[model samples]
Target: MPPRQSPAQKLAAKLLLGGEWAPVTNKIGFVKRPVDQAAVEWRKWVQRSNFQTRDGIGVTEHQGTLTELLSKLLPLGYGTRWLLLETANPEWTAVVENTTGDAHFQYVLRHHLSEVRKIPTIEVQDEPKNMKRLPDEMARGRWGGRNLTVYDEAGFRRSLSLYHSEPWKFHHGGEPYDFEDVEQYSAPRALDCFPHETLVHICRNLGLDPFEEDFYVPNGRAFIVELLHDGKRSGGKKYTLAEARAGHDDISVPAVDDPVIGNALYPSGSGNPNPDAIFPSTGFESYARPTPWDRAVKEFEECLKRYSSYPVRASFSDGLEDLGIIALPSLSSGGTGSTDISVMASATLLESPLAIREYTAAFMILQWRQADDSSAFRSFYPNRKQMAVIRRIYKEQGLYPFDAGSNEVYFNLAVDKMIRSVTELRLTKELVDWEASQPAPSTAEAAARANRSCAWDIRMHIQEREDEIWNPELDDRA
Candidate 1:
């Protein structure tokens, strides 16, 4: 419980706030402090006033002690202290112009806590405000002419102040890109359109951190995409098709890690090998150097040679592994493997260019599926052309015998059945139920358990296998 304010302190606060504090009291005769409400109004008024002069919040003798009272008070929520300090100190007054009063107060509070509750230097300047004459050691930011720079005994900057005036790039998992390209304009607008509260809700649903820059927006987009494409009514502000589509478009494209390295990491081995380059500890040297496409083709051929005689396993863990395509959540001891040749065959076909494209497209489509909506799983809906593509690709790889139409029929049935199974796995309540059954030691442990059982994690695992199969450059053998 907060310490009760004295009548004198309450009157002083009311004066500092510029009006009567409409205090709320319960039937038990407990008065609820009007700090939050007062802070809001006080902030608005302060924004419109010149707070640099001494005649700011300290207008009256009682109000003059407002800052002193705030400094002594507990449970005022940083907002109240911020409101008091914004007027009491010229530096903080300048801080209010660039950032929310709450944010500036947080920085101050953080420093105070870091120093074991010992306050940093707090000086009152009676001279007129002049930006140019401010000391070089003063900590300030570029946005507002307020420098709050504090130095330690070694004359080193001690505060975590953000001073850059450069425009921040809108990043999901990478550095901000120039939005001059017309096609790229949709992404930022989509981000701006969604309310912060909605983003928090979506992040919560996705089992993602609401405050993490990389996790929040990307995962929120996925949840939002399901809402939009499933024709379900979204909570909060309703968005148009254009807004939803733009958000979906932005979300669908995978963010690469370090594009420069991504593009150049696997350049042709044309340069002379470094004499000092350490050979494998196992005494192995490069026997062959194949391009990603070549390596993928070789892996597919090996899969055909090994698994074609036997039926493919329906369990992804088994089928993919047997086909020399390892994925996440390795066998995990005693897991059953289903013998579904077509699905195994499909995994083998990933090395094929057409198969890669088809698989990627299907995964993207599956990603949009809502757990409750059957219509969301329309990505693998079989068609004559798609079936033909699968058949032709398999035949071209020599996995299917020439004139063996029976194999084609088996492939179609297997693929359709596999798609249904995967969809069920993704949408089923088993993972959720399993997670709910577990006892966790802490909130963090519970969150980790939730992430492990999340539908998105499963989907990403499957997607990762596809990525490995498609990019043979990542294969250990390659």
Candidate 2:
């Protein structure tokens, strides 16, 4: 519970908010506070920031006691704070625009808890508000004239993912040209689109401290705020947190310690990779928790070769012990939880010829990791020709990802049966899920896993195998 705010303090809070606070007991406000606080770190941060002039939630009759006197919601722990709230498009746009992530949201969330619930609302700004200069940062953001119209973070990444299969050359009949040839456009590194990276960027730009564990946990005390509307925002277009993850994956998200639902959170690589681009050891990751597997077709697409996808030349299979990656064949593809990372063949992918085959092979391995019966997992995608067949069946036969385990013969056979046989599918899953899956968490783990995968019989089977390709035209929709 928050310490009681007095009548004067309530009035001051109203001044701080620049609008009316929610009626305290009615609890009309949303279940909030800690999430918004962790995401934006507003209520206490403004109180603590140093400036010759300041306002809202922090100013006091007596100064110098910033840490001891505040709420106790945002507790410090690994992978804890970001768990409080899920973000969508509207919230993303707002945080980019102002100190408070969303004023409209703040309005909806006012008077939301024990301490925050009591603050009075400011009906109108004093005509002399300008003289106060920095009466509050909220005033500057809300009234300060930086209303955001869109979240540009999702910009053009889809173009990158579709590069190979859906080439600009094929789409518009234009001559071969790179994505960079377009005016006023430059591609963002895979790191730039990452959800966690965006949050770190926002905090540093605000001149506020980043959520690097030590700095974020102590001042975080807004957990008492209830979750209102089931964590969805009111009156917005609502691009889901999942969509953001997809867009980021199409561009960038670093490797986590675990390929799926990582036990450790350090990034293996990032988009920008500058000293600044080097991700903080601790911060928020908007990546959604791993979706549960249907458990039916768990061993769907196992393959033998593992390698660094970049050059498409090196194989880790022969020498897993050298790399230090432990073998988990004790856990077969079926024994392990799936990696959600999927990469698409972006429109601009045509420009990078080398990545085409590499992307195709890696995409297949990822699908193998996640052997769900979802429509996206029903087939392998080695090329555009194969993807076309899957998409056609998706439209004609009515297969959807959410349907998971229950769909009639997708083209003519039940989806799981199709997976048991070799077939081609579309490149629809995001690279984030793809990126997240390729970890040993340690080189030793990678080596050991490879060792298990290629153990005696498996190695003999690989030598005995002939590479088979399915021609989509051969499928008479049967």
Q: Give the per-residue lDDT digits (tens) of candidate 1, residues 1-478.
A: 9989543334223221321111100000000112222233333333332122111221111122332332222111111212222221121211111111112222222222112223232211011011222354332211211112232222212211112123211211112223213243234543232223333333233232213223211211100000001112111222221222121112223222223331232132111112111111122112222333444434543443332332222112122322223221111100011111222223333433443323322332333333344332243333454445444544554544423344334332333334444543232234334334534423322232233222232333333333322233432321
Residue 53 in candidate 2, Cα distance off native in Å: 36
User: How many pairs collide in each candidate, listed in order?
Assistant: 6, 54
Residue 176 alpha-carbon offset, candidate 1, angstroms: 43
Q: What are the Cα lDDT values of the candidates?
A: 0.25, 0.23
Query: Which parts of model 2 have CA positions greater than 4 angstroms off?
Result: 1-447, 450-452, 455-478
lDDT of 2 by residue, 1-478 (tens): 9988543234334321222211110011112223344333332322222211111121111111112211111111111111122222112111111001112222212212212333221111111011112333222211111111111122111111111111111111112134223321223532222222332333334332322223322433222211111111111122212222221211133212122221112132111112211111222122211223212112111121332111111111222233342221211100011122222222222122332333344333433323333332334322445434444544443432313211211221222223334434322234223433443534332342343221222212222231222444533232
What value does the lDDT take at residue 235 in candidate 1? 14
